[model samples]
Target: MTEPQCPLHEGAPRNHVLEDQCIRKGPRRGMIVASSKIYKDGSAEVKDRLKDGFAFEKRSCMHCVDPGCVSVCPVTAMRRDPKTGIVTHHPDACIGCRNCTFGCPYNVPQYDFNNTWGGIKKCQMCNQPGVERIDKGLITGCAEACPTGATLFGTRTALLEEARRRMKLQPGDVYKYPMGDVSKPDRWHEKAVPVYHKHIWGEKEAGGTNVMHIGAIPAELLGMPPLGERSAASISETVQHSIYSYMALPAVALAGLSIVIQRNRSQQDDNEGGQS
Candidate 1:
């Protein structure tokens, strides 16, 4: 039997060659090229790039609007800023209970099990006091680091608009996609937009998220699981509120139980007195 040729061989003179063909070609030789005007003018130039079906995907923070980590943290280590809508954690207060790990739907919270002290760590969007990227008018490391505009950082609303715009583009059209932080000026790349799958992953997953993602592949294929409309944190809060809606409810229940026990004790005391 003959060995298969590498699909990415450069001498094949094609975009992609089969392993059995033993060919080579230049990069993107067969791949569709995007229009340069899209980057220059900020418009969608392509549509229907997907030879296969497409799905919509967006880059978003894994934690939903109301995050499970914020709700289940025993030491109040997990906190969400109302204004920025960023979820952050205080490692000093964290007992390493791993509650956040169990609570998160996306399984984003990671633990440093290898540490001698054994602590938990996860992406806080590089928002430490000195390393505040968003506050400093910069994007997170991942967004800045991404060579392709695959991951973008911006206000939730603006990112949604960009996603919608891309969905409208015809395949093979070039689009100038923003890179780094959307709130501030940063690096940008112009490239042909691939046929998208048609769903923004973070737009409404578990009631939305701050970060968002766009991808050529289906999110499910990338290990992102399906989720319900309501975020896990929202569900937990509703249950807690229902049981403790009113402070008086617990107080009243406690009083009634106490009264019944007291009456039983009094009856027993009377019976003992009579026998004596």
Candidate 2:
């Protein structure tokens, strides 16, 4: 996908959909994004992985139900939509804290270091205002721009069912896979199916994300974050609440310290009396 502008130096890969396992946000030098943007850094990638051993991976947001970025945000700037399960950020409300950059394990959020005024930019799922394409009954821009039906947009339920259906199909068999929105049959275009991976990414990672993926290659090669079923954000928040609930954290710590100090004083007094 073409970025709003070239975030890197004067000449760099403009916009391309990568399915390899390379990290999107690599080490950078100041405002110049000098990270590895190529499909294959060494012998790992460049093109799509076939069914033999190479797996083609799509790099995108996990959109976890309990994203760490959202949890760590000082403000409620990063929030998940209760109904649609879409994670979006509000620029006006954003304080440019960059807590999200550190919070995310996948590093999906892209910061435009070029301009000091720029806020964090990531795939808001085309939910930007005045471009509510999903609300307007159209698929995401990426899905629409996909000429050969590579990228697709649909409900998590529909996509999961589609993935399950594709898994049952035998290799080398000609099956028409839906290109666009799976919910609306009329919007879909048929294409030859590629062998799908047994596992579906985002199904259970970090308590599961709404945007799921099923690829030919391992999910790791595609740059998806390695996460567990329980979301890190959820666990961290739960632990924090348990420790600090009712503002008892400070009180408990103080009480314990006081007891220790009193015991030490008593022991010193007993030693003096015995010596006397």
Candidate 3:
């Protein structure tokens, strides 16, 4: 008898993991298409879903309401845009301290160690000039590339509502899943929903994130670790603010100490002169 072959080894030509299996399910008003056969891959070929499909697990930046990178950037290189609430980085102002690296819990920031003039690189949510998809009322590159609606882009409130709705779904129930950016649904995938873990990954982690995720497997299995409510950045900022609340406090203390020392020195000089 022939030995059983591993499902992964069968090389199933990359299973369709997107919610919609139909080729004609995009905003193009034609066949659903992917620009490339392999969107992304892992070290091992068979370990996870091949490039054409979505995985059971999803992870994204825990866009902490209180972010650590924002606190640690000395030159104000990292900032949260008030309009979108997306974390933006300014390479021009960056002094390359790498303080943000130590502060980030998600480890999303990447360093450009290869460059002679080293700098940092991270997901700017496609907000840079010319690549401004979100600004133009479009989707981010990752969200656009994702056929499964896994990586969604939307307002924090809307995304949170969508995630909550998904959690309420019973397994095997048909649901309409939005794809390629929630703000503008250029594409859509419809299918029977997979059973999801009760908890939303970024709902409350480190005081919440704008980008959210829902998955069948636990977050830890998807490379996300369990975290506490207090974000590292929040803690650092609290300590910093407490110590430097007012300039007047330090100034007054210094002035009083200086006056005492000067008076003592004058008295000592007079006593020495009289004795001489």
Candidate 4:
């Protein structure tokens, strides 16, 4: 069977084993869009200083603290781990409503259109059954296989600390960047730091995300959506709870249905008597 290929994969710089181990062979069949731009300059300083360069922005599920996907999933198909806070999807429980797709601000969850029996597909942090990398105490495939230590895996707390450290560094200063796992890295790659943006992408964005990002350029330039600190999910939940408190909406609907049925029955009896 011909698998659906990512249309955006061709022009962008390919990450090692991201397509092979995490995408095609794994449970996920969704496209992880990576926005990129090519740069060229004719100025003497630009020609002498830098070679052909490209800027890339890779985004997966933000896995929000107050996830809209989990909130909107009526069947509880999309759930967040209480301890780990990882948002996961249960295919068996899925009704194929595609509610989660619309709920997510990052547009992470997607339907597998090419499959015979299509389902929702997104990164579950490789913790799903038969491919439980996180449960097995191993890092994700993308993190494990990244040659340049571009991707690192760890607890949210540790990552935030690391991100803060990076933000404080001078542009040309050499720093020992960890590879693979953040807490217990396989090795350190020392390199001169580049300029960094002051903001952390996911921090306080729609009530924060477990998967945060810190980069050189502004996140908006890299296709990250602008969001408020207050979560959309939390706001919606508050409104829904107030309206449906004490089963008021359901009771009102039931009462309306009963009245309609009673009126219909009365009209039928009158018509029957008139006909006789």
Off by over 4 Å in 3: 1-60, 241-254, 267-276
lDDT of 1 by residue, 121-160 (tens): 5556667555676678666665666665766677888888
**Per-residue alpha-carbon lDDT of candidate 2 for residues 1-276, written as tens digits (9 for 90 to 100):** 323222221122344222222344443322221122223334554233432233333444567788888998898888888877777777878998989878887776666666669777666677666567666776666565554455667888888888788778886577776666766644444545556668887888888887777766556655555788998898889899987786797888999999999999999999999999
Tens digits of per-residue lDDT for model 3, 151-249: 677888888888888889887888888886575687788887776768887778887777666666556545565788777777777887887877669
Clashes of each: 37, 3, 1, 0
Model 2's number of clashes is: 3
The TM-scores, one per candidate, come to 0.69, 0.73, 0.72, 0.73
Best by lDDT: 4
Q: What is the C-alpha RMSD of each candidate to the true structure, in Å?
A: 12.3, 7.6, 11.8, 8.0
What is candidate 4's CA lDDT for residue 208? 93
**Worst ten-residue run, lDDT, model 4?**
1-10
Assess the local accuracy of residue 77 in candidate 4 as a C-alpha lDDT between 0 and 100.
98
Greater TM-score among 2 and 4 belongs to: 4
| lDDT tens readout by residue for model 4, 84-198 | 8889889999999999999998878878676688788776776776777788887776567666566778998998998999999998899999998999998988987877778
The candidates, ranked best first by TM-score, are 4, 2, 3, 1
Error of 3 at 257 (Å): 3.0
